[model samples]
Target: MDTCTSFKGYGRVDELEEAAFKRKTRNQKIILSISLVLFLVLIIGVVAGTLVHRKNNNNADEVPAAAINSAEAVKSVCSVTLYPDSCLTSLSASNTTDPEKIFQFSLLVVMNSLEMVSSTFPKKFINRADDPEVKEALKVCETVLHDAVDSLDDCISSIDGNQISISKITDLRTWLSTVITDQETCFDALEEVNAALVTEVRHLMKNSTEFASNSLAIVSKFLKTVEENNIPIHRRLLEAKHGSPSWLTAAHRRILQVGKPKPNVTVANDGSGDVRTINEAVGRIQNKSERIFVIYVKAGEYVENVVLSKYQWNVMIYGDGKAATVISGRRSNGTGYATFVTATFVAMGRGFMARDISFKNDAGPQNNQAVAFRSGSDKSIFYRCSFEAFQDTLYAHSNRQFYRECDVTGTVDFIFGNSASVFQDCKILPRQPLPNQFVTITAQGKTDPNQNTGISIQRCEMSPLDNLTASTFLGRPWKNFSTTVILQTNIGGFLNPLGWLQWQASDPPSTISYGEYANAGPGSNTSRRVQWAGYKPSLTAAEASKFNVESFIQGTSWLNGTNVAFDST
Candidate 1:
């Protein structure tokens, strides 16, 4: 009986194996058949799309084969972007098929949409809202939308017809990125004011933002193609022993390095310099000057708001020391001021540089959202400066900014903005917040993935000012695609082991890119960091290199002129 059972079991096993083999063969055949069908369908769809595109153009006979290929290329480029439909719609009216021309057309669409939004936003929402605060926020929206339009105009002007250089692309990306930030900032202000028309305003602005995003995507694809093909073009990568900006000439570098450069204008509270106040010195500036217009402020506490207007270009302001020369204000959102207007020092001009100065907003933590220093200046540099406040201490608001050996202190979102900013050899201090308020170090606002903007905190130190702190985190995402990296920094023990916090009760979207590489100190431990989909506790050297000065901000080309120290690697 045992022998008969063993034989029967062997027979059954053989039969089961034969059945499994047959099923595997049948599945493979089905997969092959489906794959072949899908391939045929894809070919048919491409051919049909091309034919339809030709018919829409109305003159297929006049259209060259290159034009046909160009049409297909446009479809291919749009296919890979996040909003293919929007991209196609924006490019549909373009008569030229050149990728560069298509990108230009996309920018034109963005500019037109933004212009429409700028014109319609005020009429649609400002009068509808009865609250003064809401109206103020709406006004802020109008201002930013106008700024966006102006930036787009500048971008369009910079492009020499259809030809766009890599450097030009870089600048275009920066400007477009700011456009996205400006739109989101409007929404943020409206949300803060609790405007009832916030949703409507957002809806009105959605298409413009989407068009801008598509333009960014299209340009990025163009850039990638250029690089991959090794197409020779006008490219400038500034290489110098020390760091500087494009406009910083060798003479300027010498003066800055010598540390005793003669000032074009001077400011002092006492009757010792050319002017009694910084603003007075600013007023004397030659609008859009190409040379470095130097202003030396003697050591004193100037309790006045200083603004470097957009018309003032290549202005360099330095002081005796961060501790001795102080600019202080008390503007805060709690005091009915919009966050955009709350900065004690507002730098809006291009090539604005400040060294050894202290910007302070003394509104206290109770006032909420006080900004000490706000920079919208492109290619701006802050060296050995200090920003002090209880919240939003340093608003690196927009553009390419670099901060070296600076000190920033705040209770919440101390270092925040949408700029492609890097902080090297700086100190980030978090002060005690109001009861039950948590401390967050950085809140980077990168609304679009192609923005080429992020907060790269390299070789910095993060420590708390007061003891017995509540939960502290590295940062919370201010936008969906916010990007930040803490590389080779020293974190204090006060930071929560989780290392990062969500923006609200729910976890931030997976688009937020938070990375920490080769950080030291107790808080740098990744064993218990937040398990969010986008949080990267450990990154390899190659991955971290992308956030460095050279790759991140194209710093090598521009920093050679600033005479500031930077690490390209």
Candidate 2:
């Protein structure tokens, strides 16, 4: 108390100390408040960061591992295609890892794109076309594009939810290949009529064609993977060792196997049968009939154009003989008809069979690009038939076709098309050509390397129908990857020393897969054959077998029911 009371002039010493203490307590409170505010800020930051991390983890977990894996797998699948970028972009939206599903998506993408093209094509070009030829070609494009769309529809239906059966794949490849052919046919028609429009039309259809090509590649890869991995699939559609197609009922097989099955309908010029013309017989057929409808075309010269449309299925038409029963027409490209529409007998139905029949286009060499027998028939068989014309005699137009003991006679491109066709023990007779026009035996139109299409003349005879002053060639590559293999066949001496010819005057394209294996006769000599990059003068036996019936068309699976003789090896 005495120390506190000392030397207090302005104020008491106790009061001064108490005032200093109050000021110090105020400063401490301010410091405490600042620290509390900082701690609260730190807590809020830590909580926010933790919530963000948890949310990020949750978002990643929402994407299943399978989806990530599938996306990667899709990338891998698309990587091997010719149009990888297109393939990837098309399949980007697909979310499944199943290869089959991926393949189905590819097909759907192609289908949608094609449908768009088909719809817009007519609207874009057909109405504006001025030339009659151009207009006709556009119309033809419209038809073929529609047909292509239908084939794609069939393909999608075949694989929508079903396991990829061997038969289903075969059908799919055939139809898809046909779609490619249809696309090219449009171009070919346009090229013939108005070359100026080709570039534009092709530009318009570029996406569709590329998508189709990618789908084909993916399908082929899928098949290869399934086969290599020994994956079990529905094999019921696979060919039995000695039986017909599994879809054929016992009664149908019996009827097909018979030497002279009773006819469901008949055609005769002299009123011996039910109908007088082949068109009438075709008209009576049930649309898309599962059962084989038999038509007995008796002996007569029927001067008519017969078309078995795609809606008509499994039709078997037989005649007395090639000479006795003749269906003749005179349509030709020179007569203002497109080469495709100039066909005398057009077969567009699947499983179409003709026995002992004759199809003729009387439009001679003057009528360029006349087609006698145009077959878009899948798994079709022509036995003991004859196709006679000046140009494009046997238009093996598309799909899997087999010719056994038939006669195909023409001057230029006698046997031509994009079908995976095999001719066994048939006569490829090259008649006289127009002045300065050399003869080309085959013009395989394999526009894409992935297309499983070619002309396989196996165990056949290629000779001149008459004295040939003009030179002859085994084939000319019509498209980039045109494939024509003349294997184990006889060639006449009239063929030029050069086994093959160029499609144009330029150097032959190296992309063509032309081969001659174990072929006999003078024209088969490879010493003077064109030394193109793609021409294989002498193919090994192993390579030659790839063009056989079993390997080429998978014929064993479907040919058994037809009762037609074929060499599987």
What C-alpha lDDT do the candidate models reach, one value each?
0.77, 0.77
Task: Tell me the TM-score of each prediction against the true structure.
Answer: 0.84, 0.83
Write down the lDDT that model 1 would get.
0.77
Model 2 clashing residue pairs (backbone): none
lDDT of 2 by residue, 300-396 (tens): 8999988899989989988888999899999999999999899989999888888888999998889798898999988787877999998888899
Q: Give lDDT tens digits, candidate 1, residues 260-342.
A: 46899989999799889888998888987888898899999988888887778888888998999999999999999999889
Residue 383 in model 1: shift from native, Å? 0.3
Give me the runs in candidate 2 sitting further than 4 Å from their true place. Answer: 1-67, 226-259, 555-569
In candidate 1, position 56 carries an lDDT of: 85
Give the candidate number with the greatest TM-score.
1
Q: Which stretch of 10 consecutive residues in model 2 shows the poorest summed lDDT?
A: 1-10
Residue 210 Cα positional deviation in candidate 2, in Å, after optimal superposition: 1.1
